[model samples]
Target: MIGIRSVVFDVGETLLDDTREWMAWADWLGVPSHTMSALVGAVVAQGRDNADALRLIRPGLDVAAERRAREAAGRGEQISEADLYPDVRPALAELRRRGLWVGIAGNQTARAAELLRALALPVDAVATSGEWSVAKPAPEFFARLIEWAPGAPEEIVYVGDHPANDIHPAKVAGLRAVLLRRGPLGYLAAEDPAATAAADWRVDSLADLPGLLSPR
Candidate 1:
């Protein structure tokens, strides 16, 4: 196997827990927290987009428009160091210490990119789909990611929780993929024979990554 020279991460549910992000949406939508959670779970199981949960609660709702309105109301999104997974800092720091280029790329808003940078994670780069003008599951997005990557596609490992968005696409892009079974979508994906089979490796925690990528 080719030695891994870089490790890139997906944002939601991978590095960040995102519990508060969804709960804040529940507050803005005036929906009960349990109801919001259930809807999100439903969408995840159904392989629906994350915004589908909101559309189920409010049909014809423009997610972006509502986000602007929410910000105007002083109920905007916020992410911080506290939102990070317990293993995030240590994992990224370890990877970098091992002389691996570390980066974070995911389908998120510009504000999310700013918040992530503010967290001061030991990453070489941080980018979002919103900033890239493309998103996962699209060939163009991976093209852009590869453009931003430090090494050849074969030497970069893309780590993420979602199978469709992270695992399959990165593999298709010629980069190795590591499936992290966490989050609602992640656990659901862990049940899939195909998803596990497609990944270069399947792991439950980011902490396992350093050892897995370490040279034998």
Candidate 2:
């Protein structure tokens, strides 16, 4: 991982575990947690968007509208330091200690951004798809990322749990990729050679990153 100057992490399933979010959705939909988990797994297996799980439960549902309504009803998106993975704090702090510019960016909402900033993690930047109006796996997203990044694409490493969203697209956009094998997609990628192969490095936790980025 030599030549790396910046490390940008994906939010969901990367720095954040997301278990609480899913459970909240299940409660909102009045469905069992196991049902929600099953639907999420089904969509992942079918390679459909995570939103598809909700669509399956309530066809023709306007997810965004529902989110706004949920918020108005006193229950909406919530991100807390408790949602963060155990490795997130120390990992990002260590990256900064190593003089690498650390950031957390991915397909997340404005509220998520605000909540994440509240955590005050040791990172140089924090942004999301909602803040940028461009989602990942899209060239525009990575283009914006490269524009915001402090170094060349090759010098910035984008880490996430999903191969399609993080590894392949980042690599196609000229940034190095790191796959963190923790979430659903990460377990799925474990069975796909191309997924693992696309990442410059595969790690079980963010703790592995500082050492990888260390000068060799």
Candidate 3:
């Protein structure tokens, strides 16, 4: 197997637990879980990427919108950083220790940095659609990540939970893509054959990441 020298991670399902965020959104919108869940499934079925999903939820869900949603739902506000995936920090630290350049590519607002800080999984670079105003599944995001890292795409692996957003675009950009199986939304990818085929690798937990990415 070719050795991977760098790694990029998808923020939502890959590195962070986004269920709380979605539930919070549902509460804010006064939509029931069942209702919002259906919408989420529909959004994914349409192959709408994460950015598209966010746009579909709220045309402009900026930091202010996020706060308002939480407050309206009677849920105390918390930064995105407060909701990181379990074992993410340790996994990231291990990857860095193994001499890999680490980056994060996601469709999040500037709050991504805050979340990373909260999770304590600081990476070498971060490329976000919110910052660039472009989303993934589009080659533009991956292309920008390549430019930001200035590393050979083959040497970099991108990890995400979504088949369309992470695996497809990462592979097209010449980067290996690892699918993380976590969160309720990822259940669809687990059951879908086509989605399963898109990933270069798959792990049930982020704790498996160090072993998966370690040079063989």
Candidate 2 lDDT over residue span 27-134, tens digit each: 999999999999999998888899899998999989889889889999998888788899999999998988898888999888889999998999999999999999
- List where candidate 3 sits over 4 angstroms from the true fold: 45-77, 80-82
Model 1: CA > 4 A from native: none
- Which has the greatest lDDT? 1
Instruction: List per-prediction Cα lDDT, in the order shown.
Output: 0.91, 0.90, 0.73
**Pairs that collide, model 3:** 81-115
Ranking by lDDT: 1, 2, 3
For lDDT, candidate 1 versus 3, the one ahead is: 1
Model 2 spans > 4 angstroms off: none
lDDT of 1 by residue, 86-194 (tens): 9999999999998899999999998889989998899999999989888998999999988898778988899998999999999999999999999998898899998
Cα displacement (angstroms), candidate 2, residue 142, comes to 0.4
lDDT of 3 by residue, 27-94 (tens): 77677877667777677767564334445666775745666555676774354545776587778878
Clashing pairs in 1: none
